[model samples]
Target: MAKLTVERLKKQFGTSIAVDELTLEVAQGEMVALLGPSGCGKTTTLRMIAGFVAPTSGRMLLGGNDITRVPPHVRETGLVFQSYALFPHMTVAENVGFGLEMRGVSRAQRGPLIAEALGLVRLSHLADRFPKQMSGGQQQRVALARALAISPKLFLLDEPLSNLDAKLRAEVRTEIRSLQQRLGLTTLIVTHDREEALTMADRLVVMEGGRVRQVGSARELYEEPRDAFVAEFVGRCNLLPATREDDERVRTRGGLLLSSRRRADESSSASTLAIRPERIAIEPGHHAEIKGQLEAVTYLGAHTEYQVLLGESERVVVTRPTPVRDDPMLSVRTNDPVSLTWDTEAPRLIPETAKD
Candidate 1:
């Protein structure tokens, strides 16, 4: 395991800046995920760390050793690309032992280690099978075994599960996480899938426009997003225009007063109120501070999503666990007058400057 550090990293291609002044630290044996949408510089950052793309500026350190100028082969970093980059003609054992061969390990010295690597991924029985004969998941495991056989200081995966089908992806994801935990490897995974990042990472680094937006654990980011971008990117969020009051309260556009931690700062010129759909409660009576007519209802498996049009200017979406079929209070119809209420602690205030 190794502690990886990147300081003020930058990369550019002609007039386009791919990565900009990004800096982060991954502690030894920690699993850190770089998460963002396409073109957010996640892959670029990964490549820089693997030494496939040299940074235009900044430095990289591994285990407190300066490795900014080292070549990819010398960096001792193992990379598993999105496509299973296995040799088509080589059998499982051959592929797993290829790294050892390149490093000049004798054939006798590589056999048991190769077998152990295949067994670690549960591919020991198919050691003689070629890549074409194996399933996608099996081939992926072979790739993983190949990377592990090299005993790298840092393990870097670039969307390794993207190519698998949905079901296989889920299964293989759990297997990979379990293996990483058991081995206690310091790993960095770059992925566009938000759920994958949220579930697998010990800490997440969210990026946008070639810069780091926020870095926190899943619970911290989900419960308290620093800005609109982080809130909306990590999960579903309802953003409503709001103004700060003299008493440190936030007033929504529908004239609903919501308690907030503090007023928006001067940089927060376009402040808005953000709330999760699950936080809103749907009731029949008129006790709600905000009322709206139901516009649409979507029946999800565990929950029902309701879209409510508040007055004429604002729309709020709320989701609640589906009620029993016999429950009369929740069998709501379109255009029905409904009351929506939420806990004062639920609404989060966003400064105008923080609005994305």
Candidate 2:
């Protein structure tokens, strides 16, 4: 296992800056994810670490050794791409052993190691099958085994499961996490899938437009995002513009006064308040509730999402448990009168200018 450190890492393409002085660290035996949308420079950062894309300016270190100039072949890092990248004509055992063979491992030493690697991914039984004869999930496992066969110091996965179907993706993610934990390998994964990053990473680094937005655990980013962009991007939220008052409170444009722990004295006369849909409650005929008309209802398997229009300009989203009957009491339809309420402590206040 190795600790990976990136210092002021940067990459540029012509006039556009891909990665802008990004710095982060991955502790030994820890799993860290570089998460963001396309063209956010996450994949470019991964490529830099793998020596696939040379950084315009930066330094990469592994276990206190400066390897910024190391070539890909001598980096001792394992990489798995989204497209399995396995040789179609090569058998599973042969594919797994290819890396070992390239390093000139004798046949006697390569065979057992290949078998062990396949067994680690639970593909020992299919060792003789070619890549063409295997399912997408199976092919991915072979690719993983090939990476592990060489016993690399670090493991890098660039959207490794993006090609698999939903069910297979989930299953394979679990397997990969389990395998990494057992091997105690330090791993870095780059992905745009929010749930996958939240589920698999010990810590998440959210990037935007070539800069680091926020770096924290899944729950931290979900509950206490630093700004409106991070809040909206990491999860579902309802943004309501409001004004900062003297008593540590914010009054929304719709005449709703919300109490919060944040003092908005430094903020301008206008600010934005964010709340998660799950935090909002649909109370029936409550006088203290903010009045709204149900605009739409979406029945998700575990919960029902309601788009509530408050007053003339304010809108809030609320999610509640799905009803039991076809038409339950909470089965509010479009244009139906409803009240939206939530705990004041749940609201996150952001300066209007901080909003993206």
Query: What's model 1's lDDT at 90?
Result: 92
Compute each candidate's TM-score over C-alphas: 0.94, 0.93
Scored against the true structure, residue 53 in model 1 reaches a CA lDDT of 95
Candidate-wise lDDT, in order: 0.86, 0.86
lDDT against true structure, model 2 = 0.86
User: Per-residue alpha-carbon lDDT of model 1 for 1-356, expressed as tens digits?
Assistant: 79999999999988889899999999988999999999999999999999999899999999999989999988988888888889998998999999899899999999999998898899999999999998889989999999999888898999989999999989888988998899988999999998899988899999988899889999878877777788888999998888877444777887766665563442346477888999998876456767788889899989989898887768888998888867754667888888987776787876533533
Steric clashes per prediction: 5, 0
Clashes of 2: 0
